[model samples]
Target: MKVDRVLLIAGGRSGEHEVSLSSAAGVLEALPYDADVAVIAKDGSWLLGPDALDAIDAGEAASGGHPFPPPVAWGDYDVAFPLLHGRWGEDGTIQGFFEMLGLPYVGAGVTASAVCMDKDLSKRVLQQAGLPVVPWEVVRKGEPAFVGLEPPFFVKPANAGSSVGIARVERYAELQKALEEAFRYDEKVVVEQAVSEARELEVALLGNVRAEASVVGEIRYDAEFYDYETKYTAGAAELVIPAALDPGTQETVQEMAVRAYRLLGVRGMARVDFFMSGEGELYLNELNTIPGFTPFSMYPRLWQASGLTYPELLSRLVELALE
Candidate 1:
């Protein structure tokens, strides 16, 4: 299918609003087509027009004086590219909205978005499929308890991404504070046992029906952990494509990534994260349906390493959506 008019949606009411705008910028610069960008304000208003991209480029709202339309009116474009991350965007809300509008958008569908956004549910599904995941316990508001898990675990919001609200609790006494921090982002929190000598690795998956995994990439950071700041802040982390792993290990990571992608029913694109322990054990961490599109992000960089340039990568994703 030949895609002409493209509606690029970005920004949202989530904590990753600024980051989403940055992702939209990269998508805008790399798109092969003249895409009409739309910005979803923090209040959930859709700001769009020919000048929407210009307003987003200046980090300003396009709704100040422009006429904003509802999501149902997005049928003007042949395809839509939603770069909105976090709650309202990546969590299946916007995907369902697009589906209701009879609009085909890039990336996973409603089911995939919802299942992957919720860490607890995704973990259960992945584990049931015989995939190895980091051992963890779920904590609710007043029902917090660690049955068999030990301390020195990482506490994170079950529905957030990019390490928005994550904490490393080394002692039992720190559990409450960590849970509080995590609860700020989500109702359910996951406390995972820290992987010893763990190495952060990621793989980018693309396509529908039969998805393909890109070469694995490793993340190296000097921060205590890969927190939100370390992920977005310049120089806080370095991504090594082809991940310095042995050929066998690299192939294993890629294979498992593809398996998880297909099992999760992810259609267009996804970034699968893994944790490799010092003993060579690999654990499926989580999946990001609409990963960051910035130049430095691991998703595009992995595809670029696999011989797909950023612009070509964006084009392929749009084509996949149309397919």
Candidate 2:
């Protein structure tokens, strides 16, 4: 694909705002082509060009840019790279906007983005596809109880990412408080059964219709669970690539990752996470449509381990968008 100008959109009102900024920085440093930068401030305003780069450098949280203008006014570019994570960014909202502007962008389309952003809906879809998923129950605010899931459950906002609104509840009594915290992020929440002594595994995916999976990776952490701090803090978690799994298990993980990626309608890229029990049982945890791109992020690192360099990966993604 012949490309001239690229529009890289980042930052948003989601809880992952800071994380998005970090990912944008990593992309900016390694992007092989000339690109225009656009930052969506916490107030839902837009920042363009050098101002956007300046905000990212200064770590500014508020938008100093003007309110979002018409798509034509955003400037002319060959394609857009919406690097924003969480809510409005990762959900179908921005994708739909790009669609209205008749612009090609990176990552999943509308239906896929919307479904994958909601944990409950995605789990249901995966289950319907005959995929093994961790048992979970959806709960709404003011609900009396969430049945079908036991204690030591993971309560999380169905629509947020980067562990932004997540909590570990060891007992039923603490469910309400955890629900309250999750509700702050979204109206609906998911209470998932925690897998015991399970190893956290991940697979990076690329391509559109015929997506390919990278070597399986493992996340070894010492925290109670992989929380927001543990995910972002330097040296907090160790990412093991080509996770020491037997050939059979590794093949199974790779196959499942590809299946899930196509099933969820994901394009360009994604990170498929899984939980493996000591008994060798594997359960699909969740899929990240816009996985982190920080220095410590597992997405690009998984591809790097698979022999794809960072700049190469960025160029390939742009080609995919143009494709």
Strongest candidate by TM-score: 2
Candidate 2 differs from the real structure by a C-alpha RMSD in angstroms, to one decimal, of 1.3
Q: Which lDDT tens digits does candidate 2 get at residues 180-278?
A: 899999999999999999999999999999898899999999999999999988899999998999989999998998998999889989999999998
Highest lDDT model number: 2
What's the TM-score of each model vs. the native? 0.95, 0.97
Clashes of each: 0, 0
Candidate 2: minimum summed lDDT over ten consecutive residues — where?
67-76
Candidate 1, lDDT over the whole model: 0.86
